[model samples]
Target: MDTMLTDIPGMATYLDDIIVMGSTERSFMGSTERSCQVLNRVLEYGFQLREEKCIFMHSTKYIGFISDKNGRRPDHANIEAIQNMPAPTDVPSLRSFMGLTSRCSTFLPGMHQARGPLNELLSKDKPW
Candidate 1:
């Protein structure tokens, strides 16, 4: 896929997903057009794009984040995932929960303090 994408100058392709964005109106249209050209090239290579995966200017969430004039923000679905994560049981499970919290910690200020109770359990002197 890297080789296939080498000719496309204005997008980032991860596996089969191609992501493109631009800060200016003109650049944004350029990005879209460049992506279209790349897609055409891909088609010429006898590869097909899945209609479901073919997203345009609109996306509820792209790669778990969103962007626009407001700047980038975490997707609502991502926030809900952490909120809905189940309580952890043992030290390892607690660690996993802590990991999830850390991933979205920016949403909650003083997040380090929130992990204090859990971190205490992972302390070396503390036995599981």
Candidate 2:
């Protein structure tokens, strides 16, 4: 899929999903052109797209984030999930929570400092 769609500008593919982004704010014509190119390429390659799953918007959710002309940010559901996550009671659970938070660390400033105390609890010499 990557080989097939490699040169198309503003197009991204992950597994079976294809995302075409355009700056409708700049020029809706340019956006439409890109979308056409993507569709043509998909048809040329004999790949079928399910129209029911397609979304066309200036800002839309992609994978785990909300993306727009401004850029991507953690989706509200993702943030809420993190906030509602149970406090870790053991090393394994702590690691699990840490792993989840780390994925969103780009959206979280000063995460290292915030997690410093919790991080220390993972140290080998620390008593449980």
Candidate 3:
């Protein structure tokens, strides 16, 4: 992968993911096109990207989050997982849920402000 992709500019790797980034559309397209040509060469050399795993344009899911032209957000898969989860049944379970929520909401906008009420629920004086 190293030698094959070395020719492509603006390519960054985060663990198993490759990030192609640019500050403007024109620049991004140029980088993307160049990367594509290089990737094709790599493909001919025997490596292949999974069809479903490939994403392009202004947004893509990386690790457990989604990054876009605008910025970043929680991964839809993670959100759906949380939404499908059964409701907490006890204090410990509730605390567990709160912990996950806090972690996932770190990059979320207005999290601190909107989470005030939820955060207050964990207070000693509050009823669960």
lDDT, residue 60, model 1: 35
lDDT of 1: 0.70
Which is the better candidate, 1 or 3, if ranked by TM-score? 1
lDDT of 2 by residue, 1-128 (tens): 87778898666788888876656655433666766887899999999999898877889887788878876788999889889999888899999899889979988999979899989999987877
How many backbone overlaps does candidate 2 show?
0
Clashing pairs in 3: none
| Residues 1-128, model 1: lDDT tens digits | 65676666545566776665566657756756785787787887777778887665733356667766455677888788787978776877888778766766776789978787778888887865
Q: Estimate each model's TM-score.
A: 0.49, 0.59, 0.41
lDDT ranking from best candidate downward: 2, 1, 3
lDDT (tens digit, per residue) of candidate 3 on 1-128:
55555567766666455577665777676755686785786577686667697666777676677766666678877777778777876667777776667768876678688667766776786876
How displaced is residue 74 in candidate 2, in Å? 0.5
For TM-score, candidate 1 versus 2, the one ahead is: 2
- Candidate 1 residue 77 Cα shift, in angstroms, is 1.9
lDDT of each: 0.70, 0.82, 0.69
**Candidate numbers sorted by TM-score from highest down:** 2, 1, 3
